[model samples]
Target: MRGKRTTTGAAVMIGALAVTGLTFAPTAAAVTPTTATINASCGLFGGGAATLTATQNGTSATITLSSTAIKTPLALAADSITSKLTMVKASGGTTVFSGKKNPAMAAQSPVTVGPLSGTVASGDSLEFYGGSLQMTIFGISVTCTASAKQSPGPFVFD
Candidate 1:
């Protein structure tokens, strides 16, 4: 009889722990329009359509830019290009994400940068138009600006 009671109590405790774990589990974050596009022009270097991908976790976020239209004129070693990307806020003002993060690229390879980290708030709308992307490669600074607002609208974070 005592053994039966002990077994039942342990089983109940295990069930309670399972329920507690489910109650405290983290939830998946939601960010509207995970992808955005812009027509960027980097004078003298190159430019065209570029894709920007965004992800959010709480107040921390990341943005990655990739473009087949913009290619490196020369080979670039991994994490060698210094890049700073500015973004406009719909409510006014701007935010910047700068880093020297990239993969090695051969001459004429597509340009890709980031996983650039930034801080964002819920309901914040970020667009690239009024902002700019500056990349310094081998001492040459190339500035790229969005010709217009990003398509599919700005990224709305939650």
Candidate 2:
């Protein structure tokens, strides 16, 4: 009985010591986050003032313009012209604003696109514009402006 008590006490002491050692042991430190993704579509806001028209089927986006500051230089093909555009990331990224002008006509006003001209944050997107495109039937100059936002959500289409 005496021998058994001593063995039992030693076992208890060993367990206590093991627990104490584990408590003091060190392994690694803390980690941080760097990247994030937002999932949404029909961007909430900040598409900008320049107008836009788009039809999406996969990665290809087709857009047209009806107004611009300079109305003389190039005649945009009714359907013969196209440009690349990206969804404006509300986090402060790049966006595209396309429009047409035939200043040679001498009595026209530039069309205003929307989401309306306003301030945008990171990661919001939207587009505007529609209808058959027209021109003076000759090559004329066309100027385009664009807007975009970053640090926000993803395209609802994807």
TM-score of each: 0.84, 0.26
Q: Please provide, for model 2 over 72-108, each residue's C-alpha lDDT reduced to its tens digit, 9 standing for 90 to 100.
A: 2233333322222334443445444333321223333
TM-score of predicted model 2?
A: 0.26
Model 2 lDDT vs. the true structure? 0.33
lDDT by residue (88-122, candidate 1, tens digit) is: 99999998888899999999999999988889988
Clashes of each: 0, 33
Worst 10 residues of 1 by lDDT: 27-36
- Candidate 1 TM-score, true structure as reference: 0.84
Which candidate tops lDDT? Answer: 1
Candidate 2: segments with Cα more than 4 A from true spot? 1-51, 68-88, 95-142, 146-158
